[model samples]
Structures are given as C-alpha cells and as structure tokens.
Target: MVDSIIPKPKRVDGQITGLAGELFVAAELLKRGIQTSITFGNAKAIDLLAYNPDTGRSFTVQVKAIRKKNVFPIAHNKINRAHTYVFVVLNKPGEAVQYFIVPGTTLEEDPDRFTHWFTDPKFPGFNWRVLQDLGHEDAWHVFSEQA
Candidate 1:
C-alpha cells in the first residue's frame, strides 16, 4: 500500500485548532523543563509565554496552526519582532503533530519569506514545507536561548 503525500486534514473548528496548537506547545515546553503559560485570549499578539526558571528568562510566542501540511496564514503587519513564531501542522488522526519554531526576526528581516497571494492580498502566509526546509522543525533550543 502507498501513502498519500498529504493526508486528509482532520475536520475541526478553526478556534479549536488554534487552541490545540497552543496547548501542544505549552505541553512541549513543560516537558522540556521550561515553565509555560497560555495567555488565553487576553494578549493580542502573544499566545504563550515561556520561562526558563534556571536562567530566569522569559519570552513571548505566537502560534500559527493548520489542520494539514498547508500554509499558515499570517498578516504581515501583525508579525511581532520580539516574539517567537511556532508554526504547527496538525496532521490526521494517529499522526504526530509537527512544529517549526522560528524567530520573528527572521520574517521581519526577509520580506520574500512570506508568500503573498494575489487572490487574497491581505492574507499573506508562510508555507509549511518552506519552514521545514529551512530546518526549523522542533527547534526547541530557541526558547532556551531566549529564555
């Protein structure tokens, strides 16, 4: 039997998908011995705040999640330079979720990194594969370095 290149995405609400991504990130951080907290709709740009208790450092994170291996929609103007960006691919059932941890400065310094669609000019986004190719998958060390 052959496997599909892109598995069918799980049918889930957008809000739920976003929340799942945030929770998953928080869990991963905690597992790595970092303290994490979810802002839960209070913060406009930040979704998670993580702290390295050992280092006494904290940093903000913004999560963008998609149900499948697709583009993670982002508004160019809303990219916060001080916050880290975690792009998540929530694959089908029984499949492991994938994360691409990228620093916001990367996107801020490079305009070509964003794929701006002519059809939806206002909703420019980053392709999941592109992030993977850039070697950002599971880049958990970013938090350690920042926090």
Candidate 2:
C-alpha cells in the first residue's frame, strides 16, 4: 500500500492561506483543552485569542502562516510581551504542519533579527524569520506553564 499526497486543500488560491493558518492553530489549541476564539478581519492584529479556564490565564495570539518554505516575515509594528506568536508552516504537499510558539519579547528584544525584507522565488516582502535554533519551537507552555 502507498500513502496519498497531503489531504486536498479545501480551497484554492492564496487568499485562504491566512485563514487556513489561523484555523489550523485555533483547532490545535482547542484539541489541547484550551478555549480559542478567532478574531478574523483586518480590524485587529490579533488572529486568535486563547484562554485556560482553570488557571484563568488568557493569551493574545498573532498567527503567521507560511505555505511555502521560505523565511516568512512577521510584522513587528506592535510587540506586546503579553502576546504570543504562533508560527504555522504548512509544509509542502502532503507534509505535516509545523508550529512555533514564541513570546513577543523574543522579537522585541532584537527586532532586526526576526523582521526583515528579502526576495524569494515566491515573492518580495518583509517577514520575521522563525528559526528553530531559538528553542521557542512548540513553546505552548507559555500558556500552560508546564514543564
């Protein structure tokens, strides 16, 4: 038996990428027994709001979803220590998803390293580089505070 390519994408075009990333993260939070609410639309910078009912701990999540494999740039106009960044990388066709939860302070401390402008085969724009070496990968404990 052979495995099939990644599940067919529900929608075509790049318009849905942002929403797809947001929903994907939101779903993961929910699966972890955390309550999540999406704040769609350009009205707010926060994409998802997560909360832990038991600890009364809530978090403002800014999700950055990258469909292609490049250094994705995250806007750093407003950096809030209380906020968390959920970097969702939708690996190429049929691959698993990658999540990097980073605290706002991580970026605020050194804005230049994370945020920058560059051109790739895909497009030319600014994005915050989410490198795994930072040790922030899958840092969900920012909300749970568990070891």
Candidate 3:
C-alpha cells in the first residue's frame, strides 16, 4: 500500500509558536528591568501585562509572529487601551530569528492610511511609508519616545 495522506497545520504549532514568542519578549523585558506577567487568555483586555513597580506604571503587550514582513498588523483594537503597544517582528532570514519592535500607536496614526496602502474594513491598516520616513529601525524601545 502507498501512503496517501497530506499533513495540515497541527493545533500545537500555533500554541508553541505563541508561547515561544511570548517567552522571547518576556525575557527581553526582564533584561530591561521591567516586571512582566503572562496572561494566558480571557483577560480584561491585555495578553502580556508588564509593569515597572519602581515607576508605578504598567503596559499591555500583544504579540504576533510573522514569517513574512507583511503577515500581520502592528497593533489591534485590544491594545487601544494599553499604555503602550509593541510589535515584535520576528524575521527568520535563516536558522536565526531577528526581532524589531514598532509602536502600535504610531502605526495607527500613520497618514499613509489615506493612500490605501493597508486596508481592512474591520481594522485600519498601518502606514508603512510613514514608518519608514520616521527612521524607526527594528528593535525594542519605549513607545513614548519616537517620531
């Protein structure tokens, strides 16, 4: 007999990918002296709740994994109420993955949306042109400090 079965995306693939990404982001936050907590699901409005008790402030972070440059948006509506939103772009050029952080708010306000570069009836598209013009490189930084 010949094997005639095709493989599909396993449920565990998504869970593993999500957890791994969260771990990467959380580890980075820890290195930066930010207190971080992981909320599994069904929370008030955030996924990862990170805080700096010394500063008495907290930020809600939503993580998205991308195999390509334009697979996902920088932010979603869930992060609208967050003190800060981070886009952890994972670029896997080869065996290694590189990360670039973009501010969700900036993407939302990008004027390029008027040009129809990114279009979604339910959610607005980010302005890639504006993001490029601002000289925002790919890395982790405070959302408050940007163009």
Q: How displaced is residue 16 in candidate 1, in Å?
A: 0.3
Q: How well is each residue in 1-147 modelled by candidate 3, as lDDT tens digits?
A: 247776677554655666677777788788778888887764345557887756666677776554435544533333353345444445464644435455556445653533343455565545433444455444555622323
Please name the candidate that would achieve the greatest lDDT relative to the true structure: 1
Better of 2 and 3 by lDDT: 2
Which regions of candidate 1 fall more than 4 Å away from where they truly are?
1-11, 114-120
User: What is the lDDT of every predicted structure here?
Assistant: 0.83, 0.73, 0.55
* Highest TM-score model number: 1
What lDDT would candidate 1 get against the real structure?
0.83
How many residue pairs clash per model? 0, 5, 0
Ten contiguous residues minimizing lDDT sum, candidate 1: 111-120
Please write out the lDDT profile of model 1 over residues 1-147, one tens digit for every residue: 366577788777888999999998999999999999998874366899988987788889899999899888876666778888998998997999999998888777775755444124666776888888878899998877733
Task: Name model 3 segments beyond 4 Å from true.
Answer: 1-12, 42-44, 68-70, 73-83, 89-94, 111-117, 122-138, 143-147
In candidate 3 the C-alpha lDDT for residue 31 amounts to: 78
**Which runs in model 2 stand beyond 4 Å of their true positions?**
1-14, 112-130
